[model samples]
Target chain A: MSDSTHPDGYVLQAYHDGELNDEATARIETHCRDCVRCRNELAELQRLDGLLADIDAPELPRPVWPALNGALRKQHEARLGPAFAFSAAAVCAAGITIGILLGPVGKSDQSSTNGTTWEGPSSMWSGGASASLLEIHLSDMD
Target chain B: MTGMTDDQLMIRGAAGDEAALRTLIERWEKPVFAFLVRMLGSPEEAEDLCQDTFMRLISSSGRYRPEGRFQSWLFRIAGNLARSRLRRRKILRWLPLTSGHHETPAPGLDPLNALAAGQEQERVRAAIRQLPDRQRQALILKRYNELSYQEIAEAMGISVGSVQMLLHRAMSALKRDLSRGRHES
Candidate 1:
């Protein structure tokens, strides 16, 4: 069974932060007075906190800041030129591709083999491609 | 005094103010680098991520809403990146540091007494490095950055209850490690 009265987790947390008000503090202090295990755990944590703060921060070499600045500046420049951006180009390219693929359907005799596959546009290109596949099938059937 | 307020720097930075950006770098570079270096396990990778973190901040200037503290937001970013890096490496959740010197240096310890303090800081650092990712993150966020338990949970995307458990486990682990170290010495 868990230690229901003074479950160690939150008590240590509160004690370390100095967040406990006087009454809660008094209760914990009273408990620590008697409980060896809890007192030992709390003391270790306090010591650990002191040790960690003493460590020095790492120092970076001088040029790295300029390098970071250069990168940020470059990104900013790319963002500034929206018209020439690749995302914009991608959208335009996708629109054109979609238009070509879906712009015209069966309203005109554009794709049929028997119909006047459009005069100037010459439906022959599309029809020829389909006919080539059909020719292979016919030969195979024969 | 070393850097402008988070909101001030962010606003100026969004306006393309280079000086404001540099001020931020000067202020946050060490703690940020320290966290990344310890988490990523390489000074080189830490530096790269540090640069990348600032670059992101630069690009995302106005995106920082006034409601959130910049430090917490920045830490959340670091925590996310660190987690992804660990996950990508398929890391094992190793046992944490059982004991060592405190996370913070005791403020009142006289400089002359540094030697007698019997502290081997590298031992503590290595121990921290060995902690399971979540526990280490929780401990570092709490001790080094002085984040509240709720803030740590928020930064790490864990529940506050989970944060408490992780810290408790971490404390126990560190205590055990320290006792072992003490006995050996």
Candidate 2:
């Protein structure tokens, strides 16, 4: 662009994307019609974009259906009402089960809570739930 | 299935054709997922988010206008999801790509040994990731989505001038990077 022309990179991008208006596009085309450097640069950018087209997508995960399945099942389930209750109930059940399992595992060393040996990774692994996750769950409960 | 355009597919999808919906999803899922993966640098996250976009589409069946292009609509939803993720992080997560290998060879070079497409893809991905977010957006929209400047501007909520400037700057940076490749071994 000349001194009087637009200094904005956006206008140039518009030109590159072929989004410029007729007269403006005509003007830029005219410029490229004469300037070898600008023409070469344009050619180079096109080449780079072509090179970029070589970038293929990442690997698709296995069992991609689960996510899509949930979405699909929920399609009609929402109209029936209380459909999400099972998920909530499952969480509560799991919470209670985890508490029971951990309570026994922690006291297994004492041989008093079911008189079993503690052959676990340690008390740290006993808390299946992370502290933050526990706090978040408790906070939600409250 | 055979005669349907994208808009028709969306309309059919809206009318509860699971197959039509699946077809639509199949058509655009890869590119949108790729867009998200590159943007957020997490394939797992992108997969989750891509599923969410489709979920929204399926659930919002009645809301789509019959007149709009399904591709644009799908992209608008994806763009919104991407924008929300960006806003929450206020950061870029650039995953390196690994798929730029030439099948035969560089036709012009005719070298003895072929360059690995994976490494070339990685280099380009890294260079793109280093770009400022807006420039990256412009470049991705044009180069990946193949949207015109006006469409990209509309999608990005910017002017044509801004899009041009972003592309100009991005190409300049890319040119410099490409030149560096020449200077190295």
Candidate 3:
């Protein structure tokens, strides 16, 4: 067989691997039978495969599940930890803001209904408190 | 659960089913570890990376589409991690004081070689270790893992033609390397 007619190395390797389709396999088989070069190439590829097959993977020292499970658990917790903390902080902040907004209105309503202005703190504090109460009252009225 | 396919198990695993995850670990751990051990040449590192691969599988399972190619996807994750680990090892090899500590012994030199059993096997392991990473990966995936060309292409994220070429080059190199080893000895 001429050099040009012989299968390429990849095609020969594919043939050795049994990866070629039936038609291609037949073509290669016919060509290799007549071509010493292709036959040598296939033999060399098979020898290489055998050499590679001789090396075995070492045994695992122990079952990986215990350590893997632990790592996964830690990872799962690590993922949820920050989100859980953020959610709790958000809830706390919302609760605090709601208390701040509603506290003065209830207090002012009590003070007004009691007929005595409770001078519990400086006007600076009362002023801010009253401003919040006004905003709530206005919003309610609207 | 054991009868369920990898995609089915992964779907359950994504939904936080511990049993499915366990089943997956049981089913895949050995083959993955073997692949890693060959790729990285260290059973210790392979074991660690195998766990990491499954961990990645679970974490990414939510996005997994069941295409009957779970093994390819699983190996892709493992292959990426192995490549990253190899890169890190290369980088560490350049550092001054720590270089000695991080030197990768040929698999033949590994204490675990006692299990691998022969000097011939050791030479083969060392030859495999010397191949360029992509060629080595393609060769191992095809030769040891018994992946079809399409499956190897999927696992390595290369085309089937690329896989064929890699395997061709890899086998040629191994033949040359082994012949040299034989001549030297």
Which segments of candidate 3 are over 4 A away from where they belong? Answer: A1-3, A82-142, B91-117
Docking class of 2: incorrect
lDDT values, one for every candidate: 0.67, 0.66, 0.76
Output the number of the TM-score-best candidate. Answer: 3
Task: Give residue B118's lDDT in candidate 2 (0 to 100).
Answer: 45
Ranked by lDDT from best down, the candidates are 3, 1, 2
- TM-score (0 to 1) of chain B, per candidate? 0.76, 0.77, 0.84
How would you encode candidate 3's per-residue C-alpha lDDT over B1-185 as one tens digit per residue? 98999888888878867778788889988888888887887777888898899888877889999889999998999999999998888833221111122233455565566443466766786778788889989988888889999999999998999999999899889888989999998
Q: For this target, which candidate reaches the highest DockQ against the unseen true structure?
A: 3
Q: How well does candidate 2 score on lDDT at residue A33? A: 81
Between prediction 1 and prediction 3, the one with superior TM-score is 3
Error of 1 at A79 (Å): 5.7
The order of the candidates by TM-score, greatest first, is: 3, 2, 1
Off by over 4 Å in 1: A1-5, A21-23, A34-36, A77-142, B1-3, B91-119
Residue-wise C-alpha lDDT for candidate 1, range B18-47, written one tens digit per residue: 667677777888778777766766667677
| lDDT tens per residue, model 2, B1-185 | 84677788888878767667777777777877777676666677778888888888877867888765556566667777876876787764444443222345545643443466545766787788778767777777778888777677767777876777788888889878867975783
Ordered list by DockQ, greatest first:
3, 2, 1
